[model samples]
Target: MISSIIRTMITEFNNDVDKLSNDLTAQSRNHVITPREANR
Candidate 1:
C-alpha cells in the first residue's frame, strides 16, 4: 500500500512538471514573436 501511494505521488509530480514546462515554453515563444510584431 505504501509503495502504491508513492507511485501515485510521483506520477502527479511528473504531470505538474510537464504542465509547467509546457506553459513556460509557450510563454517564451509568445515573447519571441511579440517583439518582432511590435517592430514591424
Candidate 2:
C-alpha cells in the first residue's frame, strides 16, 4: 500500500516535470526564457 502511494506520487511529479518542460520549450522558442528564468 505504501509503495503504491509512493509510485503514484512519483508519477504525478514526472507529469508535472513534463508539462514544465513543454512550457519551457515553448517559451524558449522565442529565445527569451533562460535557465535561470525557468528555475524561477
Candidate 3:
C-alpha cells in the first residue's frame, strides 16, 4: 500500500511537470527566452 501510494504521487508529479512545461512553451512562443535562460 505504501508503494502504491508513492507511485501515485510520482505519477501526479510527472503529469504536473508536463503541464508546466507545456505552459512554459506557450509563453515562450509569445515572449522571448533564450535557450540558456530556459535551461537555467
Candidate 4:
C-alpha cells in the first residue's frame, strides 16, 4: 500500500513538472518573438 502511494505521488510530481516546463517554454517563446517584432 505504501509503495503504491509513493508511486502515485511520483507520477503526479512528474506531471506537474511537465506542465511547468511547457508553460515556461511558451512564455520564453513569446518573449523571444515580442522583442523581434518590436525591433522591426
Of the candidates shown, which would achieve the greatest TM-score relative to the real structure? 3
Model 4 CA deviation exceeding 4 Å by range: 32-40
| Candidate 4, run of 10 with poorest lDDT | 31-40
**Which candidate number has the best lDDT?**
2
Comparing 3 with 4 on TM-score, the higher-scoring candidate is 3
Q: Assess candidate 2 and give its TM-score to the true structure.
A: 0.75
**RMSD of each predicted structure:** 7.6, 2.2, 1.6, 7.4
| lDDT of the structure predicted as candidate 3 | 0.80
Computed on alpha carbons, the lDDT of every model, listed in order, comes to: 0.75, 0.87, 0.80, 0.75
Worst 10 residues of 1 by lDDT: 31-40
Residues 1-40, model 4: lDDT tens digits: 9999999999999999889766666766778545444434
Q: How many clashes show up per model?
A: 0, 0, 0, 0
Deviation in Å, model 2, residue 36 alpha carbon: 9.0
TM-score of each: 0.76, 0.75, 0.78, 0.76
Clashes of 2: 0
Better of 2 and 3 by TM-score: 3
Rank order (by TM-score, best first): 3, 4, 1, 2
Cα lDDT tens digits for candidate 2, 1-40: 9999999999999999999888997787777787677767
lDDT of 4: 0.75
